[model samples]
Target: MAANILTDPGLMPELRRVDHGFFGPDSVAWRVWTHPSILIGLQRAVAVQFLNPFFTAAHDDAQAIYKYPGHFYDMTLGFLLSGILGDSRTALQTSDFIMRIHTRATGIEPISGRRYHANNPETQLFTHIDGWQSMLKCYEVFGPGPLSPADDHRFWNECATAAELFTCKPDDIPRSRDGVREYYATLRPQLCVTEAALSGMRQLLATSGPNSTAKLAAFSRFATPATLITLPSWMRRLIGFDQPAAVDRAYLPFMRGLLGTLNKSKRATRTTVRLAAPISGRILRQHWAAGTPRRAEVATVAEARKLYRQELRDENGFSSDTEYTAAH
Candidate 1:
């Protein structure tokens, strides 16, 4: 049967509410959960980090860039897909969307004088680089399947051509500083075309029925776990869960609900979970590993669910157990 949620737009708002409750205000996590643009940028960054093992090796610098902006986008993509598909199309469409945005944002078109403060040159520039890097990574993975090598080369050429126009020294590319009107002007056309293309592509893909369904299913896996882990740390801490145990306590039910949902959803096929399990495990093990004291405190899946239900009783709130077991 077709999923009830596949065509529902109202669900987006509920997803946002869940996200807000998990991330909280004043935390860096809000930027990604609330903003589509920032979230796209982050997905691009994760694509880059995933493809380029160098970033993984350079963990400290990578974490610094990723924590605020990069992590936000990663979580956003994960959340969006989690709410939509889970892990079915993990990086495919997301990478495509981000690349399309990058292609337009960094192109040579002029920006209209009346744009938001956030759409200034610096933001566009940083987003451009992040997008280009991500697109390259996507090209490395899925691009080769549907696109010709010539197409890949041409795309990279366009990206390089755009990058050169806005840079001075080879390494000193202009980025979002304070008020970057000129940069925005340059990016306007590319951004417009890119967005249009993305819309068209989304529509076309959406109509493809089974393929679209499978892709979205793949995406959901990546989305759910990342949201369960990342958001609560920031939100609960903001809500006064200073102790690691308290923070973990607050996050238990949410995680269990998340995992249980994944286990039950029609989208949660073997391919989806199998593909996602390694990525999820790696992210959890990496962040929650012993080196980082805060991250180190996160519990395993079994432990998290047990504790989550315990806290549900303490708060006198019904747990998602009914839903969880019903799915089984």
Candidate 2:
């Protein structure tokens, strides 16, 4: 995939543009992603990054990050793999687990809120699972081989219960929200395995084939808009939502500068093809390689303990007697 991306004359320019946007000086996305304090601030920024489109659709950042040209790659590749590799069972299971996490993480009842949050992680996970089931159904209809029993029961059950909860219209429990806030405030921890799993998934899919690359590019594009829409409302308020002009004035110059660099590089006669392609490819490959699979990686709970122990060993670090809270 790296080799193809590097050698493809047509893709190099666009890929270069993407790299510039992600890594260049004007990159708000890069700035937030690489911040040292990846806590409330970064989380809020990320949420805003994903949700900018629904609230404000006038800018290039919204389009670039959320809705670009290639957007169906991941679903397509997943489907392709299931058809060819006979691993739909595994993919379905994996999708189910991720969907459950999404449900819990987003605090949304998956089945009832399915339509409104169709692009939400939880809904998307279910969609992926449904796709797998549909594939099984297709196999039953067309193929001579025996079809696998549908694994939809558990998912359906959960979704149904979630829908019932939604129908019940539970009263707004202020105390519950307060408790959640307190819990998160004390547990300043990152889900290391989740990060690792996503990373590994990307790497595995990237190395799969040219089709996989296309799938990834497509999936990212399609998923970007939903990400923007589902971002917390608070983030929009923080970024001077009322002062659109000011926000643009503060940020657009950087974007323009980066875009200019990309445009210049594309037109440069001396620019070698090999160098252009590999720069972004290397960065992406390294990122994916670092990610661990969900099944293989240590739990976040365990990783937090290890981090605490390392911190304790430092002379300037908090003393053993000092209490520490998990910071997500």
Candidate 1 lDDT, tens digit per residue, 122-188? Answer: 4434544555443333223221222344544444333433332222122334322112335434643
- Supply the global lDDT for candidate 2: 0.27
Return the TM-score for candidate 1, rounded to 2 decimals.
Answer: 0.24
- For every candidate in turn, the CA RMSD to the true structure comes to 23.6, 20.8
Error of 2 at 112 (Å): 12
Against the correct fold, how does model 2 do in TM-score?
A: 0.20
Off by over 4 Å in 2: 1-71, 74-122, 145-328
Name the regions of candidate 1 deviating beyond 4 angstroms: 1-171, 175-182, 190-200, 203-281, 290-328
Per-residue lDDT tens digits of candidate 2, residues 249-291?
5444443343334334423311221122223333233322333
